[model samples]
Target: MKSFAPKFVWFDGRYVRDSEANVSVMTHAIHYGTSVFEGLRGYWNSKNLNIFRLEDHVKRFRNSGKVYSITLRFTDRQISDAITALCRKNNARQSCYIRPFYFVGRYGINLHVTEKSPTHAAIVMFPFGDLFNRNGISAGISSWRRINDSSTPPLAKMGGNYLNSILATQEGKRNGYDEAILLDHLGNISEAPGENIFLVRDGKMITPPSSSSALEGITRSSVIEIARDLGYDTVEREIPRTEIYFSDEVFLTGTAAEITPITSVDGKPVGNGKAGRITQKIRNVYSDIAMGRNKKYSRWITPVY
Candidate 1:
């Protein structure tokens, strides 16, 4: 995987070189993981560039900050504008990923937070391609269980919560799997390390509900809407682990994962072990919409130039 090396990063209240952006070692978010962030994708189509769901991503970033008590000084629109300006400044005329994050910069070990706690926000954009192999990926049912809401809010895109994901993903990689599917506290299917899981059975699409310890993914929401627009039935309910083994198709959705198909689970092939017809259709439609090729879903995009 290539590292992000953008020319300029929107740091604090100004655009600075990537080398100039730095945070204190004692920053609360660095030590205690007191931070919230969001990921967005920008697609370059021919001569036009557009960001997918820029407003929605910014709104979620603000909401995530609120949950962690890390208040952002800028409004949602301001943050969105900053991201657009940063992307343009970088001259990113290709598919790229944008990460907007706000973190606690106060130097302290105290658990108690206050409004005076230093909060810092930055937007970084860089050229990015498929996070996972396009052919398909193999997955394993991880031994690690998803953390419950009582432990930490799963809905919030917090930095600390990713520790659980790190463990699960590492376990998968060590065991010769492309990804890990984590179960909830009650041994029910939750989601993947960095994406939401969806299964297709008998031509119907189903995914775990919000109560199942899955992060409410923006791409996941987009998939559901696109599926409906394509006249496919979608359902949100509790999915058992065994259901994946028998499902006809399995895939993951997220800003990074996009719509990656999972051909097998725990060494068992899903149906014929290839991307299902419905999954391919949804993927194509999503790609078209994200790249500004679909006029019907153009409202979902925010053009950068």
Candidate 2:
């Protein structure tokens, strides 16, 4: 784990030094986790810097804010521009991760915030590399189950919801596993700590549907599209835990995780126990797209510079 300190961060209304961008201790988001955020990646391709699915990320950010009753002071285009400006100001000429967050800034203990309660938005960019082992990762079925929509909406990228993920991930790490795959309340496969899970069987790609309490990930959607373009059939349905152990291949997808192959689940080898042919093909094509080498999916990348 290397430290990454960016030169500038897009604060409430302007760029500020990384150290100057501070939040109050009594902030509502810190107390009750009432915040919405988005995670995206920007790739430096020679002289051209590109951000993947920038608009889609912004849209999700706005939607999450709306769901959580956190009003964003800026529009989608404004936020997008601010992120790009922040990256350029930091002189980030390499692959970096972008985080845009909206939170309740005012101090109060009450769950209901008044109009006087301030809302703040910030964008930060920093150098980020692989989030998981690229070779292959081992995962365990977590003891902690996935939270259902009735409690807190899992679809929104809310900060509070990640506490569940944190618990599950910590449990996996303690058990000598690379990651954790959480099952929904009904015992059906949901997703990993921070990524969507997919299993290949008989050459068809299968993943848990949104109804199964899985986050609607942008990268997951991209994988489905890419797989279809590669002449593979994709299905969205409830997955059983045992199915993963018996599947021909397994993988996870997300903004941070990207496309990570799951070699084993709960100590059981997935098929041959190595990255399968389908997973490798998808990973290679995804890498090409991220590096601006795939013109077929050029629209997915937004030029920042």
Candidate 3:
């Protein structure tokens, strides 16, 4: 499952060897975690001899930087070209994860926004694999709650926000669970460590809105649209913890994990402890789209060759 790492990298406005893409010790981002990034996958497509969802992911990469005050020096078009070039350079035409990070290069403790300091961007691709341990994982309601929006910037994909996720995720791993279902300050079901939550009741799909302490996920919206197309009504609103235990089914979504069914929570089975029918349908559709099996989204794949 291992992939090659570039000896050189694209950094500080140019592609340098990885050994040369070094950051300063005093870098603000290094000291305070003042960086933002995005995770996206380019799925292998046999028909196109490339990977899927390249453009959508690159767009999010640019938007993620803008939210964190990391002015992407390169235009969206430029970033897109860079990703394509990197994939072709590495001869990666398979399931691969692409991470684009933007950080403050020059170090300091100014604590204030520094638009003048050097900024850095890098795009790295690696072999992609299952994010969950296995299919239909049993999740648990974490004692650790999500960080309040006031405590950290909620809209940006900043590195600091992940500190909260780390705590919640570690809590679950210690408890022998696949993942953590984080609640908001007011005790409403928020989201997983990295994915959005969905609740199923009476055959309808309901999820917490962004105001309910959920990240506005790109894949979340896609699931909503796909669910509607599948004839299931979808609702985005505040969901209570009580609803989770009582639901017929539960699931999570993200760019990395896509859609994973949760059969149990807190040691209790969700609707009979098997993956729900609707959950299976959506998972199949998502997989098909990502693997280049869906003609509807044939345009989403970008051929590396």
Candidate 4:
């Protein structure tokens, strides 16, 4: 916490100090895990600042809130503006991660609808490094399966849905791996807990479609577009359970995880146990765009400085 910048946070339509901001202890979301949030990154380019895919991230955040029945009083555009303001207030020019949460509030054990329900929002910006373990994230297939879409829509990035991810993530850590890849109920490849999974085979890129009970990550789409521009064919469909075992390469993409190459899966070497060429290229392109070096993709970032 010492490295955290002394800065401002937007909460319930107001900006407050990180240390001073407070919410009710008996909040409904806190108890019931009925909250939605987004993780966004602001990069420092030594000249101008960039918040990667600002609009898209806010739109997804808004959509997540809607899925959980939390009404966002602000539009995506408005929320984007507020996020920019909060980042600037924090003077967060050093590649920061921004988090915005909308949660149910007040004392309600039975959760009796909007009559006793209150919604509160909080936005926090902090200097964030790689979310995946920085030693380049060696991974394994998780014993924990992803929650079924019928039980809870995987499309919605709700808080309750993360328990499965949490268990899988911890499983990886306990087993001396950096992350976990969870399978869907049908035993098909789903995703890493917080990142979208992609595989490279025969010089082509393939990832599970949005229907694969995945979070539809912002960075995942960014990498796909950049890959297409780089002249590589990108495919999205239902990736099978054995697809990963034979893939030449594997990687996960997200705002926090960024682009991490997977060296192995379920104890087997992926393409001679090394990062594939296509995966490395996509990672490089994404790094360039997020670093404010690519003018062709400048629209993805909003300069805070």
Candidate 5:
């Protein structure tokens, strides 16, 4: 989905007009990708917008910075407040995506970054919608292997690490696919370019473990919890590539992708080549939970009026 042009953004410590929220070309993050970021979604109900899983996203945002020694200038609570305030400042009345990030700034040509290094933080929000076909989409098994913990920690949502995702996505699009499914170094199912993968067989949900190079996705965890709450079993293990072709259902989960089913993988139709029953059920319930329609999951949402 296209992001709406925002009117204002939270830059450093205060809100600024979008045009004024600027970064230098020589910034450390631009040159060396020395930045950490997080993306969370806000859903608009009839009354107000709800920022889904704000606290969890903020905690992960902080952890991502810690992995790279990029300490944010703001505390977790301050960051969360900034995200909510940015939404209000932007007059976000529709569903939107929120990005809270910190980057190494003005440390010219420095390979070794320390906590004392200059840094900048900002929060931006814009109108967003479904990233992919929520009904179902085709996927290609990308030749690009996922970046592993040995080279870079997959758990950390660092900007440089996404080069791997970029390559996989490029290859997938070139090969006539809606998204890319990358395999781990060992040729096991890892995840989509920007989302986590789940396989259903024998009425159970299966996904690759974080050890297999999959990010510990917040949406993936939420899907597991929702599935288990619905009485479906969930498992985390290394999945062979061939198993996906045989699974009863396959879907991807992320803050952006949400819960999108895979109707076909590499031209082979999955199950009946349509969104599966369980996937539809989970997606429906997830939409409700995120949109403030499900009071039982009210704790997962923070309303921004």
Candidate 6:
């Protein structure tokens, strides 16, 4: 599919033509990956564009920068306002993906980075649809192990840390799987390359905790809350790799992936190889809340239009 490029991007506290939102080739983030980022989704319901969990995403974005000593020049409020303004400026009339990131600028091949280091920030949005096959997708256990806090801190959305995901995803593609699921250092299920993993068994939703090297995903937390609110039990525990193969249903969640089902794992069908009923229910509620259809969870959405 052809990618949809936005006409403008928010760069360094101002809106700029996408082509002008450029950085130097010698940028430190380019060479060393000393950057942090976050992904957000905006849903348009024909009348209004609502950004899902805007405050939470901005808070995490700032905290991600703090984890790497990349201090942002703008306050959280400023960043949040810019995001909404950017969506309005783009005239986004459909569901879109938003990316907000900051990176260490050109300080000339320095290994030491600090809060005092020069940094550049940018926000970009593109008209996007499903990141994976929403009906269902196939996955495989990756040979690559998930990075943990002991090494580079998996909880932080650092750019450098994604190399592990990149390699695992590439391996999955080579093996003809739609995606890759990774185990933590302890050989326990962690998460998918970019999304958190969840398995349903005996009518309970279970997922690995951050201790298992899973990123504390916003969508993951939302699903847990939504599930409990819907009278289903939710759990966070160290899940074994075998549990995925045996679960009644399996799914992955993220700002991009949303709540995509995993129909098969390691070529084995997950609960008859289709999106489970419970998974569909939660996904429906999530979509409703995101698209401004559920007024009860109105606080979770920020209207841009």
Error of 4 at 109 (Å): 1.7
Q: Which ten residues in a row have the lowest lDDT in candidate 1?
A: 1-10
Candidates ranked by TM-score, best first? 5, 6, 1, 2, 4, 3
For each candidate in turn, the TM-score is 0.97, 0.96, 0.92, 0.94, 0.98, 0.97
Assess candidate 4 and give its lDDT: 0.82
Error of 4 at 246 (Å): 0.8
Tens-digit lDDT track for model 4 on 80-197?
Answer: 8888888777776577888887878875695654523577777888887777543255788888888866888888888888988999989998988878998887778889999999
Comparing candidate 2 with candidate 3, which one achieves the higher lDDT? Answer: 2
Write down the RMSD of candidate 5 (Cα, Å): 1.5
Clashing pairs in 5: none
- Candidate 3 local lDDT, 19-107, one digit each (tens): 77777787778888878788777776654445556676667666666655666677777777777677667667557777778887775
Off by over 4 Å in 6: 1-5
Each model's C-alpha lDDT?
A: 0.90, 0.90, 0.78, 0.82, 0.93, 0.93
Model 1 error, position 233 (Å): 1.6
The alpha-carbon lDDT assigned to residue 107 of candidate 6 equals 88
Root-mean-square deviation per candidate: 1.8, 1.8, 2.1, 2.1, 1.5, 1.6
Report backbone clashes per prediction. 0, 0, 6, 0, 0, 0
Tens-digit lDDT string for candidate 2 (82-187): 9888887887777899999989986688777644468899988889889998989999999999998888889999999999999999999999999999999999
Candidate 6, residues 1-305: lDDT per residue as tens digits? 34445688999998999888889999999899999999999987879889999999999988888887898889999999999999988888888999999999988978888999999999999998889988999999999999998988999999999999999999999999999999999999999999999999989889999999999999999999899989998889999888888899999999999999999999999997899999999999999999898888899999997
Q: Candidate 4 clashing pairs?
A: none
Local lDDT at 104 for model 6: 94
